[model samples]
Target: MAHIIMIHGSWSGGWMWDRVIPILTAAGHSAEAPTLLGADPGGSRFPSRPLTAWADQIAARVREAKGPVVLVGQSRGGLVISEVAERVPERVGYLVYAGAFLLPDGASLGGTIQSAHPGAEPIFSVDTATGMTTVLPEALERIYSKTPVRWIEYARAMQCLEPLAAITTPISVSDERFGSVPRAYIEATEDQVMPLSLQRAMQARLPCNPVFAIESDHVLPSSAPEELARHLVEIANRVDHPARLRRPVL
Candidate 1:
C-alpha cells in the first residue's frame, strides 16, 4: 500500500478528488486530497501569493505522510506537485500528471496556456483588481460535460477564485532532484479546458513512462472516476510491487 496525495488544479479544492479518494481508500491505500491555499471556499483570499506557496503547501503535506507518496496532480495542480517533488523528491514515489501541465524548468503556466490558445480564453475570468481568476459558469459545461449534471452542479458550487500570481510565476526545478523521481502522465483525449493537442505537447516536452490515455474531459475525477482510480492504482501497484508491472494493462 502506498500513500497517495491528490492535488487539484486552479479554481478547485480537495473536494475535486472526492470520488477517487474513496476508491483508493477501499483498496487499502492511504490517500489524501489537500485544498491548496486560496483555492478553498469561504476562506481568506490572497491574490498575491506566489506559486511557490502552493508548492510549499503540498511539500508540507508530503513531509507529513508516513512514507514516500504517489503525488497525483490535475491541470494547474501539476505545477504545484512538480515543485513539491523538487523540494522533497525523496518523499515522492512517483509524480503523476493527469491531463496536467508538466512544465519544464523556468516555465510559467499562464505563458504556456496563452501560447496554446493564443487569444482564445475559453474558461478563465481574471480579475485585475483582486489579482485572482475564476472559472466562468459556461466553462463548467466544457469542463464537466461528460460528467453527470448533478456532479457538474456540485463542482460549480465548489468553485473558488485562484491566485493569479500562482499561475504567472515561473518555476525552477532541477534535473538532479525532480528528474530523478519516476513520473507518469494521463492524457485526457477529449479534454476541452486543456486541449488534447496542448496536453500531448506538454508531455512531449517532459516525457513520462507508461503514459496512459483516457476518453474523458478535463474533469476525469467526476467524468471517469473509476477509470482514473484504476489507473492510479495500477501506477501505484507497479511502483510498490514491481511484480505487478508485468500484468496486462486493463
Candidate 2:
C-alpha cells in the first residue's frame, strides 16, 4: 500500500480532500490530508508565515510516515509539494500535480499567475490591514463551476481567508532534488480558475509522465473525487509495479 499525502491549495484546508480520502483508503491505500499552516479558518492567522513553512509542514508529515510517500498537490498545494520533494526527495515515491502550479525555482504563485493571465488576480478580497485574503460567496460559482450547486453552497460556508504571504512568496527548488522524482499531472479540462491553456503551458515546462485529463472544473476533488482517486491509484500502481514490455521469442 502506498502512503498518499494530499496537500490543498490556497484558500483551502485539508478538508477539501474529504471526499477523495475515503475512496483512496477503501482502495487499500493510506491517505492523509493535513491542513497547511495559515490555512485553517479557526486557527491563528500567521500572515507572516513564509512558503518554506508550508513546505516544511508537509515534509515533517512525510518523515512521520512508515515508508516512502506519494505526494499529491492540488492548485497552490503543488508549490508546497515541490518544495517538500526537494527537502526530502528520498522519502517521496511519486509527485502528482492535480491541476496545480508546476513552477520552477524562484517563481512565486502570484508571479506565475500574472505571467500566464496578465491582470488576473485571485477572485478574492484582500484585507491589507489584516493581511488576510478572503473569497466572496458570490464568486463560488466561478471558482467551482463543475461542482454541484449544493456543494458549492456548503464550501462557501466553510471557506476561510488565506495568507497573502503564502501566495506571494517565491519558492526555491533544485534540479538535482525536486526534478529527479517521478511525477504525473492531472489536468482539469473545464477549470475556470486555472484555464486549460495555462495548465498545459505549466505542464509543458515541467512535464509529467502519463498525464491524465478529467472533464471537471478547478474544484476537482469535490466535483470529481472518484475520477481523481482513480488517476491517483493508477499512478501509484504504475510507480509500485511498473509495466514491462516483453520481447518476442523467435
| Cα lDDT for residue 140, candidate 2 | 77
Q: Pairing residues by index, what is the TM-score of model 1?
A: 0.93
Name the regions of candidate 1 deviating beyond 4 angstroms.
242-250
TM-score of each: 0.93, 0.93
Candidate 1, residue 145: how far the Cα is off, in Å: 2.0
The TM-score of candidate 2 is 0.93
Tens digits of per-residue lDDT for model 1 on 34-62?
Answer: 88776667686653655778788889888
Cα lDDT of model 2 by residue, 210-246, tens digit: 6899998987898899999999988776556534212
